[model samples]
Target: MSKMSASNLKLLQPSPPQDGLACRATDGALSIKTVGKIYDPEGVHVEALRDCSLEIAAGEFVAIVGPSGCGKSTLLNIIAGFDNLTSGEILLDGCPLATTNTSPSPGPERVVVFQQGALFPWKTVIENVTYGPVVQGVMSRAEAIQRAREMLSRVGLKDIESSYPGQLSSGMQRRVEIIRALINNPKVLLLDEPFRAMDTVTKSASHQYLLELYSATGKTIFFITHDLEEAIFLADKVMVMTTRPGYIKKTLAVKLPRPRQYAMLAAPEFIAMKADLVGAVHEEAVKAFEAGEREMA
Candidate 1:
């Protein structure tokens, strides 16, 4: 996968419109219009999403939370262009994204980071980080190395360039994967429970690290997590989705201040917001559970 040329990069990231209205702007914006997805395996059809619609403003950090089997991962996959929508459309910068589109297939413009860091065991930290740029011929080996070092330093991993993935802690490996994605200057970053496998302490550290990274870069992010606290703490807006045949149930605006701290979780305001989201998610979970029981019966 080659990198987009400098001109193409500029075209993808035009400056935001002068209008103050968020809905009318398209620069770096993502719009999903009444999208639906269905899977038919062995002639049995299953609907994953139905009439789901959302619009994310440029540079917004949006987190989604829902019960298991709610098609969260499916939605993320569609946005990453790995899968196609069964109905409606997904537009980035007001341009539709489809599996058949001539637009470059799932390259640096939008990158998805999965739960596992997925680093190569044989490659050193710097090697893994620079792999994309080098493979794409976007930069020479020396230039890629230099760029990787700068990013590593920004994330405070300057000393581990030569170390392999096995030598670093799980948290460090996650950081490396994030840096690798960011090095491409992607317009959007999609995270699918990237911290799910980490211990509590490590998860907390990664949260802080991610917050710092977001502050520094202001990249658009769409994060999916089952953890309610994590969703509220990290996002400017929390979107809750219903069970299978999922559609967004509600979108909650988080008024929490920037540079959020762990202490904020204990505040009354934070607790109230969490309680509201918890109620919404609990309802969906109950519905999902009942549906499962019916299938078993």
Candidate 2:
């Protein structure tokens, strides 16, 4: 069977349990409508997000960029079920997600690949990749290993199954992490600046691998990054957020053709898109800086 077909078959596999939550799946469509998040400390009310709204279709790769402390993480956390929005509702495939005491509901539909590496230092690459499925009993040990190996091979990561993360290059470790994420066939992949710590060269290579995998799997990717170019290059649409009490301030649709090429990064159209994103984000950044100054005063 073709890789896509195999992936489709894998998608039928059951999702593993998470935090006592029953595993369920979706096409990864997200609807963020008039969402608000507020925190109260010592009778002081602080708003992290206010009236934020967005519509993300299933299988669409969307990237978000914004000023520091602009509630980007807050929004992602809300969508991930780690927290609750004080106002509005988030729907998955038109059904609402439930939260407790506003506690997390991290299930299998959305998986977060964090900025910091979460790999086990003591485990081999294959071991780490197979860990989740095996532990959850969603897949037998043998089944998980077979799928994990296939995923690694597809990413052009060969013969490193026995290598420890400590022994691999930074870029290679990232590839392993990506493979680990895919073995679950999650409807959506949440990347929280997963490449932030890589050096330029390593980051570039990781980007290529990621784009290729995204094409093959057609997973809905919600990427959060400060690098505007990286966001544009990786996402079908880029959404920018306002400072402090965050909301979607602007969005740019990337017109670049699929099987995206590195050369396109230097193309005029790409440059123009980047300029637009930079301008939108810059205005918010300035606003954030001014807000900080006032707080200090």
Candidate 3:
């Protein structure tokens, strides 16, 4: 069977329902309604996003994947309420995401886990993980420390809680950062290539750990990665963006069964979906390259 046909067959199969509280009427679920963005009106005036619309149901795992510079990061920032949209709107649950051009809000319910594990170098693992709760008055120092310890144990970093970030390996630091994000009990977890730096074996282990964490927490996740295989493995739906002036070129629903294992990669269905996404990405890349040439001429 052709790849697309195989993918369709997989889609027809029923998957287990996700568990979560009903989203508030004010927030509907996370969505980008005809979003667009332009950076620096003079210097290349890059249209980072164009007429992109997406809706991610509560507790869903959606991955945004494309070539580098496809504006995936910008979209994630907008969803996190970090960047303002030039046009259109981003709605969470059902409410519009509000932010100022000069000062962005560090929303209490939304958390972003950046690449390279953005932890404080001076603080110990426990201190860094508890900082959010401390700053937000979510708990007393003693309570926060206790919460931090619990989270550290959950992520398998309990013994390293007293160690500073500089004292840990990159993988260990990522564990701490993930625990920090988890400790917030965030409504949405925005991850941008969070495991891109790890070795394959380490990445695989972390991937399994993440799946287990998500299974237990049931938080909505918006993951961004350039790795097609990673996107295939992790997301329920994978959104492919154009190379530049990024738009949703295509959105592929992953019908693969879960909890998915590495062996799923060998399935005919998995191979087909990957091929379709790869083709879509290549077409967008070619179009973007041609457009760049025209502008330069």
Candidate 4:
């Protein structure tokens, strides 16, 4: 919540990012090694994850997609420290957060944005955004108000400080939630389908808003989604997980140029990437569906 001081903040790109891509520094990295999780509810021993290894570069955006019950949410929860991994190790920026022998408690370095709106309806926009730091005493109310205003201006919501969450458009409300998270200066933003509930038009607007925010701040993002297009569109890399007892089935590097644009969606590169993802995920989805059917029978 303290000021970054000019030296602590470095602009990785001289010019603001165009084409909707973030200009990021290479720190705040994440490493997951042979990660595994098993739920022992009544000793049912559900193996939710296994042998899952991932390397996420600091300031890079990565998305993970898989069918239902494939441990997508489990992995995100573990990264956010809401759940303990039964086995494996996780390190953030080379600091161990979780290992095979111990559980990691939640900390400020990671923050999550869920699909539902989290802004306090009773609080004005400015109040909601400033509550975290100001309440924690990390910053004086005056300083937090100043910082929140600057963040609002960056996201083009400077005029809405007096407005309540009930009045802002859904897209604008989501942006505020993001600003609230960014104000805390977390190392990674964990998004659990934050835009899944929006309609097409609203989602499109929010997508651009988020793309520009990511470019400007260079915050590393770990997104979990069922939407294949959303994953490929926003991530530097896309990871596809297998059926239950999930593991990384494939990882694709998006070679599409940064400063991303909707037109790119129709390009051969985008189409090819989507096709590849569809194939990989569909295979696993079929397996998951069959397993479910057998259980029902």
Which candidate, 2 or 4, would have the higher TM-score against the true structure?
4
Worst 10 residues of 2 by lDDT: 1-10
Model 3 — TM-score against the truth? Answer: 0.86
In model 1, which regions exceed 4 Å deviation?
1-27, 99-104
Tell me the spans in candidate 2 whose CA falls farther than 4 Å from its real position: 1-26, 42-44, 98-102
Cα misplacement distance, residue 227 of candidate 4 (Å): 1.2
The per-prediction tally of clashing pairs is 0, 1, 7, 6
Per residue, candidate 1 scores C-alpha lDDT tens digits across 198-278 of: 999999999988887776667889999999999999999999999999999999999999989999999999999999999
What tens-digit string does per-residue lDDT give for candidate 2 at 1-297? 013344543443434545666444347788888888898879888899998899888889999999888998888888877777788888777878643234558766677787888788999999999987887688899988987877777666668899999998888888888778777767778888889999988988888878777876677888999999999998999999999899998989998999788899999999999999889999999999999999999
Candidate 3 vs candidate 4: the TM-score winner is 4
Task: Rate residue 203 of model 3 by lDDT.
Answer: 87
Residue 17, candidate 1: how far off, in angstroms?
20
The candidates, ranked best first by TM-score, are 4, 1, 2, 3
The 0-to-1 C-alpha lDDT of every candidate, in the order given, reads 0.84, 0.82, 0.78, 0.84
| Clash pairs, model 4 backbone | 18-259, 19-259, 19-260, 20-259, 21-259, 22-215
Candidate 4 C-alpha lDDT tens digits along 1-297: 122233323331123323554434665699998999999999888899999999999998999999989999999989988899988889988888888666667765687887787899999999998988887677789988988888786667889999999999888889899888888777898998899889998887887877777876788999988899988899999999999999999999998887789998999989999999999999999999999999899
